[model samples]
Target: MGGGGMGGGMGGGGMGGGGPPPDGLRLQYKAANTTADDIQIKPHFKIVNDTQDNVPLSDLTIRYWFTRDGGANFIYNCDFAPFNCIYTAGTFGAATGVKADMYVEISFMPDAGVLVTGDTTGEIQARLHTQNFTLVNQTSDYSFDPTKVDFEEWTKVTLYSKGVLVWGNEP
Candidate 1:
């Protein structure tokens, strides 16, 4: 049988026998206030893939919003890169599995104009508006099992600001 696993009755399992290996892909974000000022916040994110097969990841997106005193403001709306601006080590076939760490850092600059007005203060609430990661076979097959892919729920993180809150819960 050439030891090729293609169909039933073959000693080796079928090509799709074992199917894709279980993937333990995870996307994580870390937030920190680097400046002494409480308003400045930095968010860093990393993607870790722990699967035997090389998974093709594309169309990754993450949306974020910041809120103070019930008022929210959209902060980021773009694709997430693994390292610099969102990193992809390789291209097309050249790309290997995401075994190492890939990440990006974004800084949140609050509207100083609003803070100066002095409405409410001392606490800033942040939440992930939307995050989506799609995985597909190298052959561009959409019918691939969705369960094998990994998706994460919105994550929320809050930071303390020394300044007063200036905006109201209008928009």
Candidate 2:
């Protein structure tokens, strides 16, 4: 499991800090996986509507990025949309378990007649939006220890677009 980093910081004297601040929060994708087997990507988003005010999540869009070679690095977008994909949803206040669902589908094929030489590896990235998903309470147990237990953070949907490779040939 490869680990990534978050880019932004919390606002000073904000809700993340303490006191009367707006109820807007954002968490970005901060991890990648590059193992021998096929890559699986999952995105987790948290929305906390603690105030009496009702929050509306309309027109939300989530984007995910994937990469084959690890380097200073070229990036490719996963060919899946949030509306068509399935994702995880949970209700917990500051420490709850999150269920996983299929949020996207990925497929790859060698360009006509071209052949893949050796074992190939890739990376995946996921992003969440506030517009489509809204949180009514603080999310608990959002993070889990991969070694200790099996948690369904996301599900992968299969799309049969083309023939698969079998015994070094298209089946």
Candidate 3:
């Protein structure tokens, strides 16, 4: 298993901080199917609503990146997700050589009130398809971890009610 870090903007002070996060909402994420031969990498995001305040989530935007760590050489192709979701490839482009990295952003919007209910959760399942996604060879100062391909740079969850902003994780 690999790990990623989260910065404040979504609620709590940081990962595993004490006290309830602001707006009683937090992002819980995980990545699976992270092997060298795995043509597809799955990254799942779950919206954990911890309070009774019924905040309606209308949209979710995730900005993330993949670091080669200088391990292997590969190409990243397309991205896939369920309905109401969109994927945008970042400007840094795909990881091609040593120390190369790729950036991607995804946006999702479930049915209104699906992600904003208190004491319940809403989830998004996404995948990234790649060609030769594994790090088989290494050159000087090159590092890549298959498990670290799903790091999230930032995320924005918009809570809305009647077209008004109830709360949000984005600035």
Winner by TM-score: 3
Rank candidates, lDDT, best first. 3, 1, 2
* TM-score, structure 2 vs. true: 0.22
**Over 4 Å off, model 1:** 1-22, 34-37, 59-68, 77-171
lDDT, candidates in the order shown: 0.24, 0.22, 0.39
Q: How big is the RMSD of model 1?
A: 22.4
Encode model 1's per-residue lDDT on 1-171: one tens digit a residue: 011011113121222243432234333344432222232233443334443433222212222223221213323222343222222221111111122111111222221112112122112222222123122111111111122222221132111111111111101
- Over the stretch 1-171, how does candidate 3's per-residue lDDT look in tens digits? 111111213433223332333355555455544454444545555556665544333333343345444434334333433333433221223534433354334432334234434644434665554345544221211222334445332233233232223233322
Tens digit per residue, CA lDDT, model 2, 128-170: 2223233211111122122322222221111111111111110
TM-score of each: 0.29, 0.22, 0.42
lDDT of 3: 0.39
Model 1 poorest ten-residue lDDT run: 162-171
Clashes of each: 8, 10, 5
| Poorly placed runs, candidate 3 (over 4 Å) | 1-22, 68-100, 110-113, 131-171
Better of 2 and 3 by TM-score: 3
